[model samples]
Target: MISKSTIDTVFETARVEEVIGDFVQLKRSGSNLKGLSPFTDERTPSFMVSPVKQIWKDFSSGKGGNVVAFLMEHEHFTYPEAIRYLAKKYGIEIEETQQSDEQKEQANERESMYLVSEYASKFFQHSLLETDEGKAIGLSYFKERGFTSETIKKFDLGYSPDKWDAFTNKARDDGYKLEYLEKTGLTIVKEDKKFDRFKGRVMFPIHSMSGRVLGFGGRILNNTKKAAKYLNSPESDIYHKSKVLYGIYHAKQAISKEDNCYLVEGYTDVIQFFQSGIENTVSSSGTALTPEQIRLINRLTKNITVLFDGDAAGTRASLRGIDLILEQGMNVKVCPFPEGEDPDSFARANSEEEIREFLEENSQDFIKYKASLLMDEAKNDPVKKAGLIRDMVNSIAKIPDNIQQEVYLQECSRIMDISDEVLYATLAQIQNKEVPSSSRQGKQKMEVVREKPVTTPKVDQLYILERNIIKILMLYGNEVEDFEDLLLKQNDDTGELILEPDVQQSKVFEKVFLDLQEDEIAFSNEDFRELYQVLINRLNTGEEFEIGNVVNELEPSQSKEITDILMQEEQYELHSWDRHDIPVKKKEQAVNQYVTQTILNLRRHLIDRKLQELLEGIRTAETEDERTDIKNEVVGFNKLRTLLSERLGRVM
Candidate 1:
C-alpha cells in the first residue's frame, strides 16, 4: 500500500504536461499546450493541458481530469498503479511496509516480463524499418496488403528476422533477463539452447487496454505445410488468449461512444476497419469467443455486430461463437460478406463513408441471418427443415429476455412457415430440460436493443448552475472585480420606471457567498454544497486560496470534479452565448460578466422556485390573511425575477 504522504508529494510534483508529453507530443498553445489526443485517433489537436492547474482535457472524447486521472483514463492503470508511476517519474520515495518475499517476487516478475515484451516489440519494429531482410520480406508483405506506413507504426507492426537466434542474441546482449525472455515467449529456451519464438514472421504485438505489450502473434511468410500459418504467445501469467481481445487497447473509447462493437476474426480486419475510420472494432485472435472476452465488450457496450468472412464454410464455423454471445445476454447482429471477399480485403477496397453506409444498411439481427443461413442447408427437405426449426429454437432459448424470446419466436414462425404455438412449444421443451444444479450458469437479463445509439443527454440547469458557482469560487474567488447590481427607479415627470447599474468592488467569493446568504440558497448537489463550504470557510480567513492544497485533502472523485470545473475554458455551462450579443473574451476580461450573470441566473432560478412554493401555499390557504400573505410574497418574487431577467438579458 502507498502512504498518504507519498501520494501528496506525487500529486504536488507531477506536471500534467511533462508526464503526458512522454506519451503525447504536445506543442505550446497560449498559456497551455495542445496535441493530438493519445486516447483517440485524430487528425487535429483537440487535447489540451493546463500547466497552471496541472490538469489535462481531451475535447475529442470529452474526458478531463488531473494528471493521475490521465494515466487511469489513457493507460487503464489502477489508482495505485498511476500513483506509483508518477512517484517513480518524479523521483519520490514511496513509504510502504516490507512485504513477504513471495509477494514481492510475484509483482517484480510480472513487471519484468512486461518490460521484456516491450523491448522485444521495439526491437522488432526497428528490424522492420532498418534491416535489409525485414524490408524485403515483412515490410513488402504489409505494403502489398495495402497498409500505409502510418498504419504500420500506429499498430507497431514489426518483423522478426529469419535467423533462429538473431532476436535472442540481441536481447541477451542488452542485459534482458533470460528467465523473463522465456516467460514472455520472446525467447524459447530448451535443452540448454535459445532461439526466438517468432523468427521468420511478421509480428503483431498484443496489448492490454492501457497499451502495455502483453504478448505477440506472428504470421509465417513461407509456404511450409510442416509449420502452422500463425503462432501466438502461449498462455503465460499476463497473456491469456481466452481473456483478451485484439485491438481493445485502441478501440475502447470508440466502442463506448458509439455504443457498438464490431467483432471480427483477425488482426488485419480490425486494423483495416480502423484505417477505414471505423474505430470501434476488435477481433477474437482466431480463437473461439470466451465468456471473459464477451464480458470485456459487455463492459463497454451490450451490442456486438460480428462481421463474417466471405467463405460460407468459415461463416458456418463461427456460429457457435455467436451462440455463446447470445447465451451471455449480449445483443448480436451479423453481416455476411459477399463471396470472395473478407473484412480485410473489403475494408481495404472501400472508402470510410462507403464502408460505414454498407455496415448500417446490411447488418441484420442475429435471428434473421441465422435462419437464412440454415435455410440454405434445409433445401425444401422435410427432415432438414425440422432440424432447422429445432436449431433456431435452441438459439432462441438462450435469450434471457421474455419479450425478445417471444419476438424471435414469432419471427421464426413467419420464416419457417410454422405456427407460433408450435414454435413456443418447442422453445418451452428446450428451456425445461434441466441439467445438474452445479453445472447450470444463471443467465442475466438485458434491456432491448435500440435501433441507433444515443448520445448523452444534456445536463439539467440546476447542475449546470451549481457547477458554475463552484467553478467561479475555485478560479476567481479571491480576485477583486467590479460587479453591477441592477436597481429600479421611477421618474417623476412621465412616471416611467427605469433600471440603473450600481457598481461596487469586492472579491468574487464575497459577492457570491453574501448574495447566496441574502437569498438563503444552498447548492442542490451534496458534493458541491460541501465543497462550497470548504472554499468559503478557507477564503473567509484573510489568506490566499491555494487550490492544490484543497485538492490534495479531498477524495479522488471530489478532487477530479473540482479540477475539471477549475480548468474549464468555457464557463457558461447552462448558457449558450451568441457572438453578436456577448462575444467570447478571455477569462480575465470576462470575470465580471460571468460572475454577475451566474449570480443573477441562480437568483432567477431560486426566485422562480419560491414563487411556485408561494402559489402552492395560496392554493392551500386556510384564511384570507394567509392567501393575502402568499400573494404578496409571489408578487415580490415576480418583480425581483423581472429585474434579474433584465440584468441577465434572459427571460425567466
Candidate 2:
C-alpha cells in the first residue's frame, strides 16, 4: 500500500495536461486544451483538459477526472498501477508501507502473470542480443526483413533459442515459479516436462495500451510443411487476442495526432510502415478484424485507412472490416498496393516520401471501393445488381448517425443509378427486419400511448435534491458565510408568537450539516450516503478540500458522480444575456440563496413523503384510534411543508 502522504505528493506534482498529453494530442482551446476524445470515436474535439483545475473531461464519453483517473480509464489500469504510472512520470519517489510475506504472496493472480510475462520478454531480448545462435538466426532474420537495429529494439524484438527448456530453466533458476510460467503461457509443462513455448523463433512482444507486455508472438525461420509459420501465446488471463490490437501501444499517440490510423494485416506490415515514416499504423496480426479491434482504433481516431495487398484474400479481408467500422460509427477508407505487393513489401521497396505519396493518392472511400469491386461481377445481371444494392443499403444501415447514413445512402444511390427514395425505403425495410418481434411490439405500443405526459416519481425528485445538496457541499462546503436563521418566540406581554431572524457566521458545510442533522435528514441512496459520510469526515478534520484527493479516495462509481458534478458547465456563455447588454446574476453571488433553497427543498420533499405515508395509513386504518393518530401525523407534516414552502416562496 502506498502511503497517503506519497499519494498526495503525486497528486500535487502530476499536472493533468502534461500527463494526458503523453497519450493524446491536445491543442490549445481558450484556457484549456481540447482534443478528440480518447474514450470515444469523435471527429470534433470534445475532450478537455484543465490545467488550472488539474482535471480532464471527455464530454463524448462522459468520463472526467484527475490525472490518475484518466490513466485508470484509458489504460484499464488498477488504482495502484495508475498511481505508480503517475509517480514514475513525475519522478516522485513512491513510499510504500511494507507488507508481510504472506500478504505479498497473496497478491493478485493477474499481476503475478504479468510479472512472469515481463520477465520472459526481457529474457528473450537478452538472448537475441547476447547469444551466438540468437544473433546468427533470429537477429539475422529480422535484419533481412529490413528491420534496422534501432527499429528492432524499439519494438522489443527478441529471440528464443532453438533448445527446449532453455527459457524454462533460466526462469526457474531466477526464482520464478513454473506455476506462473505456465499460467502466462511462456512455458509449456506436460507430465514431468517443461519447455519454452517460442523456442527457435524470433519473438515480438504484444503490449497493452499502457505498454505492459501482455504476451508474445513468434515467427519460425525453419521452413517445414508441418510446422506452423507463426505462433502466438495461448489465451491467458492477461491477454485476449480478440480484445487487443497489435501495435496499438506504439501507434496510439501518432494515430491521435494525425487524426487517422493505417490498418495493415501483419506485425511486419506495421513495423515496415512505421519505419517508412507512417507512425500511425497498427495490425490485426493477420486475424480477421473484429469490432473490438475497431473500437480500439476508434478511441484514437474516427478515420481508418486500411492498407492491403492487391491479392484476393486481402480484398476479402478489407471488405469484411468495412461494415464493422461503419457499425462503430467510424469512416473507413481502403488503400491497396500493386497486385503482387503487400504493405511490408511496398514499404520496403519505396522511400518514405514514395510510400506516403502512394497512400495519399490511392486511398478510396469504403463505399466507392466496395462498389467498384462488386459492380464488375454484377454487370448486366439484374438479380446480382439488386443483391449488390441491398448489400450497400445494409452497410449504410449499420451507421448509427442519421445524417451520416443519409449522406452515404445518397452517394450509393448516385453510384448505382438508383433513386434516393428507393434506397431510403430499402434501408427502412432492412432496419424493420432487424428489429426483434418483442421490440417491434413495444414500439407499436409506445406509439399508441405517445400522447401521455411523463411524470417523475416523488422519491426520484428527493434523490435529485439530495444530489444537489451534496454538489453544493463539495464545491463550496468549507467557505465561511453569514446565514439567516429563522426562529419563533412567544411574547410574554401580548401572548403572541413572533418570527425573528438571527444571523450567524459559519462554514457552508457546517451550516448544511447542522441543518440536516436538526431535521434528521439522510440520503436514501446508499452511494450518496457513503459519500456524505466521507465529506463529513473531511469537514470534521478541518482539512482543506481538494477535489482530486477526494475523488481519488472514493470508489470509482462515487468518483464518477463527483467528477460529473464538478465538470458540468453551469455557465451558458453562448446564451448569456450580456451579449444583449443585459446583466445576469452569477452563481457566485447567490451561493447562500442556492444553499438555503436546496436545504429547504429537501426538507419540503421529506415532509411531503411523510404526509403521503400518513395518508396511506389513514386509508388502511382498521380502528378509530389508528385513523385519528394517522390524521394528526398528516396535519403536522402538512404544517411543516407549508412552513418550508413559505420559506422557499413557493405555494404548496
**What does the lDDT come to for candidate 2?**
0.83
Worst 10 residues of 2 by lDDT: 576-585
Q: Estimate each model's TM-score.
A: 0.58, 0.85
The count of backbone overlaps in candidate 1 is 0
**C-alpha positional error of residue 651 in candidate 1 after TM-score superposition, expressed in Å:** 37
Q: Clashes in model 2: which pairs?
A: none
Distance (Å) between predicted and true CA of 571, model 1? 29
lDDT score, candidate 1, position 318: 75
- Residues 1-652, model 1: lDDT tens digits: 6878888889888888778765555678888888766665454677888888777778778787788888878666767778988888778999976678686566666777877888999999999999999999999999998989999999999999999999999998998878989998888899989998998999999988667799999999999898899999999988999978999978987886788999999999999999889999999999988977887776566799999988977788778888888876779999888889889999988999989988999899999999988888898899999998899999999887798899999998998889999999888888768454443433211232343586866546677678878888888889998877766788678875667778899999999988899778888999899889988988889686777666656777778778667656444433464321222335465687877777777777777777888899999999999999889888877877777777788311
Worst 10 residues of 1 by lDDT: 441-450
Query: For residues 1-652, could you state the per-residue lDDT of candidate 2 as single tens digits?
Result: 8888888899878888887876777888877888878777666788888776677888889998878889988877777888888888778898999888897788788878888888989999999999999899989999999999999999999999999989999999998889999998889989998988898999999998778899999999998777799999999999999878889888988998899999998999999989988999998887788988887877667799988787988788788888888898888899888899998999999999999899999999988888877788799999999999999998889999999899989999888999999999999999999999999999999998987987843335666667777787787888888887766567789975545678899889999999999988878988789889888888779877877678777877888777775665433233443322222225455677667777877776677777888898999999999999889888767766666666666311
Question: How much does candidate 1 score in TM-score?
Answer: 0.58
Where model 2 places Cα greater than 4 Å from the true spot, the runs are 1-5, 15-76, 95-99, 378-387, 418-429, 436-446, 449-459, 491-496, 517-530, 555-561, 564-589, 610-641, 650-652
